[model samples]
Target chain A: TIVQTLERHFSLQDVLVGKSVLITAGPTQEAIDPVRYISNHSTGKMGFALARVFALAGADVTLVCGPTYLITPEPTIRRVNVRSAQEMYEATAAAFPKAHITILNAAVADYTPAHPATEKIKKKEAEFAIELTKTVDIAATLGTLKRPDQLMMGFALETNNEHEHALGKLHRKNLDWIVLNSLRDAGAGFGHDTNKITVMDRQETVAEFGLKTKDEVAADLLSIIVQKL
Target chain B: TIVQTLERHFSLQDVLVGKSVLITAGPTQEAIDPVRYISNHSTGKMGFALARVFALAGADVTLVCGPTYLITPEPTIRRVNVRSAQEMYEATAAAFPKAHITILNAAVADYTPAHPATEKIKKKEAEFAIELTKTVDIAATLGTLKRPDQLMMGFALETNNEHEHALGKLHRKNLDWIVLNSLRDAGAGFGHDTNKITVMDRQETVAEFGLKTKDEVAADLLSIIVQKL
Candidate 1:
């Protein structure tokens, strides 16, 4: 069991073993052309780390991801590849029903080009505009569909008013818990290996953490999930 | 001389050798949190490929880039790393004055959160509205600042009215050339290694090429630059 390797005396041997875990990672690509897209810089590091952690804890992990250079973290993990947000939604939706612990980590595009060009667009103006439309809300959908006994965790990476927004999302989405990633700290944000986080639960309790490698953050999150279970 | 490696009889040895070139690659990140960001999926392949192509042609290249998994293609390339659009603008602006050939290829976000929250914002509602404002127009600024003898090229990745929009930008930005990446072309766009490009000059002459590796596209683009020189 993964507990044998942990420094702490507390073990999640019974809680985690045989659990079904669903993790979303990477960034969704929104097409503007056959050759161009709007996307985020989610490298699948944190989410993939979580998937690995869960798998190590004897859980069955299903990782749904966007385009990336990184591969699935372990042999026991099942991976689903996707590009745009719509595709991610479909994949996640299918997997959510069976998941015991679901974590939403992918930086899904909030909006996409309303009408992708069918031909190569040539520029004639100094400034131009591309019509955009809101993408499907994947997290909200899963939050609503989750069973009472299931655990659903979400992440809110925000700047100002971070706490209030995250708290609101926790209730609005009916999530059991939410992790807040504050960009105010140095060496944090897209592509960096280190992250600082503050985890909040239903009773408004918070567990704040310092800067740590993505791998460490994964362990920290999984430990918290273990306690919750 | 890269001419020896070319399959075509035409050569650019005389025009490219020792020339100064500036190119921007990758995607600029807009922070929403200390750990989350709004960005695109620009792998820096095209810009880095341009830097490599120019260096192989004996040009002194300054490559400005955003966060990515890629490394500078060559040792001789002077690389400037940045995250946001403002940082990219400053780096490009600083390098543009000395470059004989300037290419703007970075997929910079046009708008960022007007005032990012200082703390991690939690969700309180189903739909969240993040106020945004436009970012600096790096190409237009450089276009106006460029010397008459200098050649500048821009890109227009659009969904509709491609030619008209690109043409307007050329004249409005006073650019010497512009490259259009059409989404209508299959095998082109954000994640693919192949690109199909349409080149338009100040005189409105157009050159179109089919899908090819980013490396080949770099060479083709350089050939056009050589002819213009």
Candidate 2:
């Protein structure tokens, strides 16, 4: 018991010493009006867990997240808070160049209101339509700018055709590794504290993980990254 | 010090004893698809505060609320959680007939997606439009069904034309009291724990309250209702 306690107390492995890591988390909100917005259910638990593990491993981490109540996992982590997909893209892009490893995990909105009204839109029309425009693709954009030394990871949350879609995104976005989580899986994705992930690499190698706490999943994910390094 | 401690320990006034109270709180989500939704910034602090105060006053409270992480203030208070505005309307309506006092505090959506996709909508189209249909007006419908002895209260959160908009809503919904909070006012409306409010009745009497914590505001509002009863 004493040995385990001692190990726990001084267990900083420093495996990623001198490494600069960038991570994005939570769900981006696209304002429809001054009061209303379009968003998803991401609570940033997975991404926050990833930041914590990476920090524990002695990496200098930068976490760019959307609006969420989740506290910064490590005081050392430089936290950048953004609201919209555009804001997230700008923040992530700015942090990407100096980072050794980049993780794109935020559930960024695909579309945003073409024109957010200055005032609250009154409820008058029987049928109202909100015109939407595609948000900038943060991962794909960063993928192009990635240097040979930089390792990039992306996440795909799919409701159907999970594997095919994830593989498509992996190649399309030019990621070194892709983590796939399905909404069909219970206790996985969005607001859940537990996750089941399948990590796929360019070699078509897939490593599947069982349902586990987000912290455990993060540690497993970090181990894979360390091996590649 | 001893008297103050005794008062704090035995503070239940039981002013609303044997009263049947119905309250709604939080922001109702309107589904755009399986994963995405449209919602307002309501955190339900004020409504939950009202529910807590009313429960402490010995009323039988049924709190029909929208999606929020806030816990039910009292174990004896019946809490019915609803997601969409339509669901909220049905739940509120069902509980209205038995209620002596009904408080429409939830920020119910005015519109909902006309046709929410069954699966996650893939990001393909550069430009998209979400067709929305007007949601049923819960307060107005309940107002028509209200008996002479019943009292109904409603909330108005306005960004512009604050007083006129709130007054219009109060008359249109046939509410006994309308509590107005403006977005322009700092520390008021939506997510804030503190609020500044203007209460108006059919007599055109306006009573403005200084900014205070939601719990204190709830007590003030209830005191007025007690006098009216």
Candidate 3:
């Protein structure tokens, strides 16, 4: 522990000194009404970890995050806070052109309330249904706009057919690499400080890592990205 | 501020000594699936404040709270952590018979997903509807079970017709007193340290209070309960 702490403080990897990085973090809260909302379990630990790692490596990082209580990880990092998926897409897209590398890490909701009530909806009916409409696909949209010199990556969290789902997403989003997180792994997904991840490329080359703290995972991800860069 | 702190430390009002108090606080999250949920904007500050006030005044407090990041207000106060409205109801009802006073302060969901998926529901259809069923009325259910010696109070948060809605709930739930919070008030209600409340009794005795810190509001509510006791 002491050695790790010492290493973290003493290590200065400035490989990305002139590079600009874009990252997204946290879960988007889709409003159902003034009082109620639809949200997910993402706490933004992984995304925040990535931002800290990138910032420490001397990159100019801009973090576009959804609703989360986590403070900005680094003082040098530019933080943009948004509440819904649409806002996240706009913010990320705006910063995409200037970024050398972009990481779509936020767990953006796939659907939002079709009609969010202005006031709190009173409980009158015995049975009620909430109509939801699909949200903009941030990664897919940005993927098409990515320049040849720019690198883009994203994360895939799956409960079933982990490998197949991740591969499909990597190709569909046109990401250079995709990080996979399986919920079946204990102490590995949302809310956990530790994570076990698998990195996959278009070539279907897969590199799996053991469970480690989010900081360590971030470092591993950075190491891979830096090599490619 | 120093004078108030000194008073809080020096004041030893043990009027509620040996009496058990039941209090519920925070917003219940009804599961949509493993990763998503439906929730409201209750931070549990008011409920935690009430727990602190009651505990300091020597009441044996059992605080049944929904998912919140807030820590236990007092070491002596028993805390029962719950996630959904159903869980809150079960936990509260189990402790009700022994409680001399009960305060229903939580923003319990009136509806819950009829079928929460075992796995994360994939985003497939362009439009989706989440079917919801009515949740058990914790206040009204417990109201019927209240003994002659016991006192029951509840909170009403309204967006429109505040007085009329609160009165209707107070009578319908058979509450001894109802505290109303109208969303129209700035810097008041959910997520704020300050609150503006109107306390009303069964006989229609209304006591309106200016915007005050949640702790001060808790003290005011306790004073009224102590008088009735």
- Please give the CA lDDT of all the candidate structures: 0.80, 0.90, 0.91
lDDT (Cα) of model 1 = 0.80
- Docking category of candidate 2: high
Task: Evaluate residue A126 in candidate 3 and report its C-alpha lDDT on the 0 to 100 scale.
Answer: 97
DockQ ranking, high to low: 2, 3, 1
How does each model score on TM-score? 0.77, 0.95, 0.96
TM-score of chain A of each: 0.94, 0.95, 0.95
Residue-level lDDT tens digits of model 1 in A58-104: 89999999878887889999999999999999999999888999999
Which is the leading candidate under TM-score? 3
Question: How high is the lDDT of residue B100 in model 1?
Answer: 92
Off by over 4 Å in 2: A1-12, B1-12
Q: What is the lDDT of residue B32 in candidate 3?
A: 95
For residues A1-229, what per-residue lDDT tens digits would candidate 2 score against the true structure? 2223223434547778999999999999999998899999888999999998888788999999999989998898999999999999999999999999999989999999999998999999999899999999999999899899999999998888888899999999999999999888898888888999999999879989999888888877887888788
- The residue pairs found clashing in candidate 3 are none
Native RMSD of candidate 2 (Å)? 3.1
Using Cα atoms, each model's DockQ against the true complex is 0.21, 0.87, 0.86
**lDDT for predicted candidate 3 compared with the true structure:** 0.91
